[model samples]
Target: MRTSLACGALMGMWLGTALAEDDVESVRARSNPAQGYCERVRGTSRAEAALEWAPEVFASVGAVNAGVAIGGNDDTPLGSPKMRVTAGLGYDFVGIYRGRTLRSRAEAECRRYQALAALQGALARGSRLGETEALQARARALAEALPQAETLVSSLREELRDGSATLEELNAVQVRLDQLRSLARDTEQARARLGLEPAVAEGQDLGALLTAFESADDQVEALAGGLRRARAWRVSLRGGYDEVFDEILDVDQDTPLFGQLTVGYNIGHLWQGKANAQAREGRRQETRDAVDSAPRQVRQLLGELRLTEQGEQQRLREVSTLVSDLEGQLREVEQLETRQVRRFRDYLLLELARLKAEQAYLGAHLKTLQSLLGGVKS
Candidate 1:
């Protein structure tokens, strides 16, 4: 009786799931760019995964075939016969079989690495979007602060002419106000970089760049491991059993079992192994060269992040000083005369500047995190 119904049902379910995925693959691809790219990458890996087990399956069948043997001799007396059975297994430790086994293992490892890269790529897109939102918020707040900063600078100049503020103080305040306007303009440019419109590509963001680096690195490692396996010595082991009987000889044969171990070297494989090692080493060196260049690229990006952080800090300090000066002057004016409306406007201007500084700081902070994490994609 066959007892494979449960196994067959499970296999059917797995096949059904695979067919369902194919039907939905197109729809999912169209839903989002990241998902589409990830699906394509995984599809390629699935093909690799499918073939990776073929060598193992073939080897298993070969092992079973080696276990049974039978033979009978009829050249004896008419009523007598001789029978014999021998069983043994043979393993080719060197050559095609070993190479195929190694290749299969390498392919399996590469498939797993590729899958991880695809998943990370999808997550990276979300991280890029988060960076865009933070920068956009900073740009909007800075745009509102620009006019207020201009007004404050003009008021400082007027105070300088009235002998209430020194010439040096007026110049310093003017510089700070000009710097604020420049930062606002810079923020707008950063916003444009984050936009989806047709603009000059600034290459990939830090996340995507890092993702590419990691993927390449994984490839190099997989190839290096395969090269090592190709160069190493291999050993194979096997065992089997057989039984035979001959009634004509009035004798019954007993069952026998045997095992074998083989260790071999292939002269032709030596050159092939050397060639594979050289190829893998060449690729690994190439990837290492690229990795070496990454530090310079990352340093430049980190410098930009640092500059933005410093800008936010300076702007916050300048705004705080301006607010204190405005409050002190307004307090004296309120006691000597009534200029409540002007005082209120100056207070609002200072408050607005503070808020812009805070938003810009937050944006800069997000940018710093993005640079530091610097994963591929996001």
Candidate 2:
């Protein structure tokens, strides 16, 4: 069985380099692309699942014969009796069977690895979309939002001029308008992080740059997720072969003229088709559970993104108010209003708001990665 298994390992198979870094045999071809690996795994699974055969071979070079004699003539003597003799040689065959149940199963394991690679790749890509790439997308949205904000701010300002808008209306609009400004700045920071110049330097708006930076971060998280999945699938692949063994061997009969006989089966199975099937099921269940989690993860990411946007708007309001509230005014009878004091206070407040927006973007990016990775794991 050991020898047979060793021989079987040499069977032709394709491999992919995707798993090379991990130093594992995950599929037929090491260089296989994601879809290709998945297809191979499926094929292997089907072939193994349908396995059911045991070819029997036998051969012999022995012969058998018998002879009889005729009755004697009446004249010669009634006492004379007929004579007969028989002698022969022959060989029988014990079954020599070859089973595909386990071999097909081994192949199936390879296929499973292929599947894992594909899932891993997808997860990685999706995660990438969430961060650096995703951030880039958000940047675009920020750019669009900036114009809308500017228009709203201008319109509100005009309304305030007319007596149509009350103090409350003006205050509300002012708050929203300020929020827009802060978000615009955040967007700029995002872009700079990406190594891309902001779209517009002069009043370029805040969040545009940040959006680009966020996009890159999206990529980082996505790649990380995919790698995680790929690693996990590798373990499952090995599990498939943990208990495979063979139960057949060739031997020579001890007796003499039995004519060079040569076959029989010992019947042993360490890692066989049954084990393979179980492993497959295990992986399948694992993936199914992952799939179940995907939608929820994605929804959560979306929610986070929305919240981050809202947060940015909120921060903008705080910033605008901060600036507008103390519009370079010295208090009457101000004895000691050091520049350092005012600068320090304003810096702290701005820094806090800036950090929040950055953190929101980071959170959204992380969620995107989780959702993407979750998909692959499934």
Candidate 2 lDDT for residue 158: 65
lDDT of 1 by residue, 297-350 (tens): 453444555555466557667755666776666565555543344444454555
Clashing pairs in 1: 124-378, 207-376, 207-377, 208-377, 211-376
Alpha-carbon runs more than 4 Å astray in model 2: 1-111, 118-144, 152-359, 368-378
- Residue 278 C-alpha lDDT in model 2: 59
The 0-to-1 C-alpha lDDT of every candidate, in the order given, reads 0.50, 0.38
Residue-level lDDT tens digits of model 2 in 125-179: 3322344544544444444444444454455456668864456655655565466
RMSD of each: 17.5, 23.3
Off by over 4 Å in 1: 1-223, 226-232, 241-253, 256-258, 267-281, 288-337, 340-355, 358-378
**Predicted model with the maximum TM-score:** 1
